[model samples]
Target: MIRDNQKSQRIFWSCILPEPLIAKYGLSFAACNFSFNLMSGGGFDKVYSSLPVYVGGEMDSDAFADERFELVYDKLRKRGGVFQKLAVLKEQWMIFRKIPRGAFVWLYNLNILNALLFVLLKVFRPSVQLNIIVLDFTPVKKGWGANSVFLRLINMAHGRICLASSPLFKSQNSVVLPGVVPQSKEEIPVISNPKASFLLSGVLLKEISQIELVLKVFAKLPQCELHITGTKGDEILLEHYAAIYNNIHWHGQLPFANYLELMHSVTFQLSTRDINYPENECNFPSKIIEALLHNRAIVSTIHYPQLNGLNYFEVPSDEEGLINRIQEICELSKSDMYTYVNQGARVREIFNTEIWNRQMAKLEANK
Candidate 1:
């Protein structure tokens, strides 16, 4: 636990916001925001002073005001042009200058703005302890290239690197963070429907091939149902699949609450990221965390090294394997399904907020 005296001594450069702000603005990155909030220990009221960086939407300064921090937000239009970029850089510099010396500074990612702030603090506010929370890693194509050099410089600047996935490369300063189960604002009951139903949700733009694979498999098994929800996908392709397969349902996008309700209603949450994709190794599937929290089984291709002991179905990253696994799960009796739910509940307990805070404390200690 962070001591009361140290509570106000920390600052978070955040893209995450309170639920009201999210609801009003219709923010697109809810999953990312939820994970970042939990990892940074900032969802609690007034937990840490925060500066709201670009959150992919416009904001009303009044609507953003909350007891949840000494909130500082830029009023300029986001992504306007060069002027806006200059303004943002100036604002960030001023914000860092005002922060108390020796304060703990937490950053969201290795974006340009955060990288600039990291450099600024190192040069000017040397006493401020810097730490960055890296949710995913994107490797540079050229080894020892300019981009790689910049990444290395920023990596060394932070006192500790909090990674949401297993480190792509070994780093004594890096720690793998446990997945956090988001707390629902309202009670969402788990449905006990005996029918075999599965959910596939998230940003679907990059998973077009995986979506097609799942659709083809479900087409063969008309008895089982597959629900697809989320945004940014090949809509025409999805519509074509939905038209042909009665069991495949494609819901374009849904409200956060509705998404959660649908998640709990399903028997299994599916993740079909291609294992060969380079990004797969660097990114942990947030849906797996949500599935565990909702006491639902998971069928995934990506292997989570940190969660090796947890009980969940793993399928080969191929169409035939996925088909077989789905068939196997569908044949399971009610008692067998209950066993998966029990294991998922155990996962929820294992990655609770108390455990999240303890891992965060390790980063602070490194500072």
Candidate 2:
């Protein structure tokens, strides 16, 4: 499947995809990272091949999702299939020379393994216009800056940084990249279901969303059905909870497009990130962005100032608060629900394509 002219490709997008291959260019972390690096702004218009690794929180969550594969046949669950993972590594290796040395190489991550790969790619073609974008960051002691090895690497690199607008990392020349929401004519999903439906996506990490709390809170909603997706997110625990609740459907992981398309079938969306985590202080939730783009009313606990004026319902970071919010949403009349949906629809104008292109162009040093 390697194109001989692949090397001739000018722009290269580099990021680490989740191992166990949860969402291949879909609604999972893969899609979020892809959108930021390649799909959003003008990056997609140019010629580029995506290079992703399988590591970080994704790799850890994959362990929880693939626990069965690891427990029964312990050795086989070696991160991901060797052949599939090597494909990305191999793709990057083969296309090194084809891409101009000084051409833009947008590095979307700086994980343990990905950092090494970035080094190799830069060495292969040292003149790469390196630009790094970190989706999630945890500053030490609620401060904007952290004196970590990763931060040191980020500072050492002469690339522009993109993060959620905050005073914390301003010294790094950080640009606000809240997330791209196109003002597309695509109709907002029509939810005519008599009962409410909910979506829970992203890696089901205990340190973050507390998947069990969500499940427990969701179980209390008799008029609501919760649909779950995303990569290897604590499948065993999910199944246990699913077994107890008849309405909870575990769709596992689906392609991002498929996930979005299915929005019409659901009434509302959910984004839950524990604010207690140090990382939550600096990181913005892409799930919130995705829900807004889909024009669905979201019940979330994560805080993003970008949605400050928007009509989103921010609940307390607790199971009781989540339960109360979902109850409130379910109680809304059809007309009221539509009003909430339209409120989210208004957010599309906030993320203009022209504005995004300007930011990306600046990062690329485009005059």
TM-score leader = 1
Estimate every model's Cα lDDT from 0 to 1.
0.65, 0.59
Question: By TM-score, how accurate is candidate 2?
Answer: 0.70
RMSD of 1: 3.6
C-alpha lDDT (0 to 100) for residue 185 of candidate 2: 67
Window of ten residues with lowest summed lDDT in model 1: 43-52
Backbone clash numbers for all candidates listed: 1, 5
Poorly placed runs, candidate 1 (over 4 Å) = 5-8, 18-32, 35-58, 61-63, 69-72, 143-150, 157-170, 182-194, 207-209, 342-344
lDDT of 1 by residue, 77-163 (tens): 365556456656666776677767877776665565556677888788888777766655666766776546545754765544444
My TM-score estimates for the predictions, one after another, are 0.85, 0.70
lDDT of 1 at 22: 59
